[model samples]
Target: MFPLLEVLKSLAQLSLAQLSLAQLFTATVIIVLSPILTDRIAAVRSILFSNYQDYFFPQLTMIIEESDGFSQNQLYAAARTYVGVLFSVSRKPRHFKCRRAIKGEKLVFDFVGEDFYQKKDIAREDSIIANFEGIKLEWKSRAKINEHNGETVSKYFELSFDKRHEKKVLEYYIPHLLARAEEIRKEERVPRLYSRGGSGLGEWLSINFEHPTTFEKLAMDPTLKRMLKDDLDRFVKRKDWYKKVGRAWKRGYLIYGPPGTGKSTLIAAMANFLKFDIYDVDISSINSDLDLRKILLSTSNGSIMVMEDIDCARLEKGGQQNKASSAKFTLSGLLNVIDGLWSNCGDERIIVFTTNHKDKLDPALFRRGRMDVHVHMSYCTIDGFKLLATNYLKIEDDHQLYRQIEVLLANVEVTPAEIAEELLNSSGSSDDVVLARLVEFFEQKLHVKAKAAELKERLKSADIDVDAEGLVKFLKQKKLENAKEKEVEQLLNSGDTDIDAEGFVKFIKQKKIEDAKAAEAK
Candidate 1:
């Protein structure tokens, strides 16, 4: 009975100790919760998202159901994205919205610096003002869609501020702020449109065509180098002019030549020369005439678009397109894309079209406005060979190979690509051997192509009609007259040449010569 009582007493003591521990735990938990209760937890809520069903990202999301136009959530997201926090006012908007974003930082950016602003902050307190302005962000929104204040309009940013928040959100939170700002702008804004001009030409070219690397080599041509220098100068000065021109203030070049010519390489050179991205568009991949517009509309600016072998795009490329026959795009559709109504989607672009058969293109499509510069990347001419030797071989006028090259260059219509290859082949060898081997290789190719060209010319002339011969004569005369027009323009524009100055000089010279002739006859 005594042992039983002792056991009960020990049991009671153990139970009391357990109760005391439980009470202490409860008190400690309540104390930890006291501070949290005084200050509310962050009001951040997890929101649902589907990229395809979201407004900002169309490519990342895999969409399903009601893909006809867009899902309801997508439309709402798009509308908010377009009406992106209005910018006219100096203060933040009352409502701040970022719930749907898993990567919310991507959507907003702080625009910093003096250049972006139209008005220079020329106040005496410029430093102070700039400091304040730096804190302010210029949010970039895309204009691919229309969403104005409570209405569908092209996208823009709102500038209202939150008066309630005491903390200036930019300073404490953002480090490497400028770079982050750029990222968000890239993500949220409807990217600028680059020209489909050159990219549109890619659909026409074949990857397996002879001399694929020729395109990269040909851009180094001296005339192209000079042009590129001038082009950069113009781009520097006229960057804003690109925006001002109702058109995207871009340049286009149409490179046309026979097969194995360096037309395509010139495009690559232009891209590399400018350090710009390439937008390769295949008209066949586009489903509808409208779809071409969408693709053109979607590309970012500061890019070059290449269309290779444009002649064959219509005739040879029924096989390349993956979509069904009903979705096959048309020639008219492509032509519209080059100089279409909605083509004015972006600014400062370059379009390049390469063709082995310039004659195959429609005269209307190659008109002046559609193509600014029509470059003939013909078989090597004397001028071209001199440039190749000077550029690729680094041969000076006094060099031994220079004379030999002149002789080979005179008789041959060798492509620059062919010259470049031969130069590279023996680049590590003795320069003399490299030159000799190159001349030999080129002489052989020259004979082969020349014979083929001669055969073709014979065939063509055999089929030429009498009327066509007259047309050729007329075209040649017109071509000569057109060549003279530029000279006349330069002479006239230089503030020289009185209207009758040349005529008066010629009249006096003719009178003197006639008198001299008369005296001789006497």
Candidate 2:
């Protein structure tokens, strides 16, 4: 002890440069590591204390985090919502500060307004006691933070219960929470629309979908609309039946129609009706079957996968040979994604394909387990027009021009989009004027149809057998004298007057005779 004290006193009395290089290095490292060692010791002490407490208490903790691997865990969401229900309906806390909330304000239970819950109440991070079948569980909200950055990583709920009730909690309480949370979610559900974005090949971007279309407002045939609604209702409610039959809980719809026949609108209506989010899948964007499978599997249950213009994509044809050399996206791959085992990944899903040319698509795409329902969106009809008028013009069914418009609609093959455009363009006009404009538009269409028919007949009589454009081209060609050609041109351009085919034929013969006479004189 005397020797150590004498050495320390000698070192203290020495000059700055008198110490060796090894001593200086050791001093620097010790100074730098002092705080680190202290923190490590404190952490070890806390962990030891916690371990002893847990051992004595004999409690098991189950953590429900906000996210699982790549997607959100459904149980985590349900627990979050179910916690709100506990706060609302459970016994009042021993110590809670009471305050009045604003009128009509939504509480933690969004579906339960202030008027329903009496007042908005629920404090964050407060522990709640849940009693389930005589077992007591304590739930506390917790958040994890990054140790280095001090930023929040995720929030979670810690459910601590007696270790003896593990079986009951696992078998009964968790399922009850899920079912109750689902009920709460349904009361306040707002469907969303999800589509692939430019970020990545399989990334989905979403937004709230609030399209104001329903079965009642659709221009489709009422009978078909009712049938579709019935079908959807049946599909959603048959989960148990589906399990009994050993089939996946999903439905497919093939909506095929002309360009403007409201196939998209029908999809929107179905989404709104079923409270399902829309997952728009672009086949062209998908490069391979693996990418397609990943995208489809990433989608949640109760979503509509709408792949529009399926016929336009460069997909492999059904039953084709040399599939090994086919494009990256193949019909076989698509079939596996839709109807094969991969399809069983999600439940209560609806797959919709839209195309203007249905016949151009592979027949395998429309088979029974693939596209279960085939909906043909035809041209506008009288019933559809009435629905449109009621929606746009707010007119009754017994308008003065209803009969005329109905007759014209029956004869003409105009789309609902065309009628909607007419109505939208005439928004400032009165109902009569609007109906008149629609009638005039229909009449012009009829006139155009009559002209095309007349031209087709003329070409047929002359043994040309060409289309309308070809017939017009034949008339425009300078085959006769300049004056005769000009006369034919005027007749062809005339819109109000119908082409007199017989008279035109006679004039053609006369022109030939005149040409012969002129040739003889020459």
Q: For model 1, how does the per-residue alpha-carbon lDDT over 239-328 read when each residue is reduced to its tens digit?
A: 766666655566677888876666656665565555455666664455566766566555445557776676665431322333333235
User: What 10-residue stretch in candidate 2 is worst by lDDT?
Assistant: 110-119
lDDT of 1 at 140: 27
Cα-based lDDT at residue 397, candidate 1: 72
Model 1 off-target regions past 4 Å? Answer: 1-13, 16-236, 239-248, 315-327, 382-397, 446-522
Error of 1 at 471 (Å): 30
Best by TM-score: 2
lDDT (Cα atoms) of all candidates against the true structure: 0.51, 0.79
Q: Model 2: per-residue lDDT, tens digit, 1-522?
A: 123445556668878799998876766665567668778888999899989978876789999987665455678878877887787777644444343233323454322211222233543435678899899999876776567765456767889998888999999999999998888768875677888877346346776688889989999888888889999999999999999999999999999999999999999999998899899887667777788787777777778988888776646556242334423577788899899989998789999999999888777787898999999999999899999999998987589899998899888889999999999999989999999999999999998888777756774686543465654555555333343756667756763344466766566667768989999999
